[model samples]
Target: DIDRKHIHIVSVRVDETGKKISDSFEKKRSDAIRKELEKKYSLLPAEKQRQPENLPLKRVDYKAGDVKKQVSNVAKVVMKSYRFQSLNEYRAVLSIYGVTVEEVKGEVRGKAYNGLVYSALDRKGEKVGNPFKASLIGKTAGYDALQKRIAFSKQSMKEKAVYNRSRNIISTLLANKPDRKVFEKELAKNGISVLFRENDDKRIYGVTFIDHQEKTVFNGSRLGKEFSANVFHELFNRNGRQDSSGIDYEKQFHINNQDYQPEQESTAEAIAGIFSMEQHGDDYEELAFTNRMKRRKKKRKGFGL
Candidate 1:
């Protein structure tokens, strides 16, 4: 949230050609000044993202009705196209393709084994048919292969600063742009797409990033705690809210009331009465409302005197 009315002075340019203007190495000097200003103001740097070659432009289509084939295509493509750590992270990207995966753990011949099964999803995002075993699709999408892929991805990503670049871009977008749609659009320009999983209430429970430049799909929590889904939900859902995750609003309300002199005995009660309160999250507002109503009625008795 930024003030729409404020003039956020980013840069000032002067071009008085009459006196002090010089054309010698002007381009080089201007570039240096731009870098210095960006560093000083912590502004977003110049674009460095480049789309990779041989990447698939289309995603899986769920309406085609071939569950096994559709799941197979996206499963293999996602397994090769993205770099994800855990199985859950892998499945998050798959969801956008109308697919889901699960791990079946068991023992065979006194040895532990883990296997992957992919299922197709319907328009409602529910699994519609029998799940396809990893072997049925290919070994590349299997449990063992994915384990190796995860390790290889970690080693490769650790050697590059792509993670840092993503974090910087996402952080700046979130702070500067308040709207989620705009945030997503800006990210798209940087070769990144976000997948948010929300419950029926539309509160985001999980977040995944598909960075086309880096050819990686990973969960936001893997990037850092700050990029977690809860953080984004709190940010996008609230207004002028400093701390939504950990705040005892009831206690704060009591403290504020006790610290200030009451102009009207029923101040809290009158305010609560004007606004209908419902059961939300912790319902701290409900408690505050009831207490205010009680105090207001008590003060009315004093008016009778």
Candidate 2:
């Protein structure tokens, strides 16, 4: 035998799918492996002839627990990096990350189609799954759970935008630390109302903001603790006199006109102004030079006379 390796005869039978293989399949498989081993040997140096690739067994199996942990780690990374507003969005993003999802269609436990399964590719392009069930991952990872998260995310996004806008207005109006009455007026002008919680001693304990433009109610702590009642009192003080909780209006009016509000000017407008100034300066210099030339000509005429 050219290859001095011991070979054992194993059972030869039809596969589970009723497919039959002859002795040629095993011979071909052996030849392919022999060529691979020879190529690996040719590439190795003489000093390291006993490499692990030359061992009888080369492939190793990955444990099921390790595979599950890898999948869950990928899921956690995706969840942190992206906020998927819908299940389709989640699937699309997951596909980009080498994970594929399939919907389990049919009734389960007397319900309609309400399950999902996922698979991932390993390093060798082999599919591996400790297949992740939707319900098993967590409550926020299921089909209906994603729908609820989408709704909440949309609302939260809207609230954040309104909060930023309101904060900008507050900063602009209170740049000089105006009194409580003026501060309230400025907020009302921007279609925002502030509610203060009072204790039994008529002292303010907390604050909440009601934005008419966004139709959302947010407590001071939700925006941040810095926006709470104590901070408001500090902002509204004037000349050692402070009154934080003084506004009393049954019905709040909407800021119908945008003229009362101020927004940041666009960069294009500022750039145009700069160019305009430079153009005016150049025109003035040219006019001054022309006037000097005229005066020089008149002086030459007088000297010649």
Per-residue lDDT tens digits for candidate 2, residues 1-305, read: 11134466576578778788566778678667767877888754423544332112111123434544444444444443344444444543343234445566688789877666656654232446557776656544566655665576456655466568766776687576777666665676676655444433433444555444543445555566667666765665434444533434333434643321211221111111111011111233235545765899999999994
RMSD after Cα superposition, model 2 = 28.4
TM-score of each: 0.54, 0.30
Q: Cα deviation of 71 in candidate 1 (Å)?
A: 2.0
Model 1, backbone clash pairs (residues 3+ apart or across chains), number: 1
- State residue 106's C-alpha deviation in candidate 2, in Å: 39
Q: Which lDDT values do the candidates have, in the order given?
A: 0.60, 0.48
Lowest lDDT block of 10, candidate 1 = 270-279
Mark the regions of model 2 whose C-alpha exceeds 4 Å error after superposition.
1-155, 237-254, 257-305
Tens-digit lDDT string for candidate 1 (160-252): 475877788898887784656556556655656576655446556667786655667677877789898778878877764322223221221
Structure candidate 2, residue pairs in collision: none
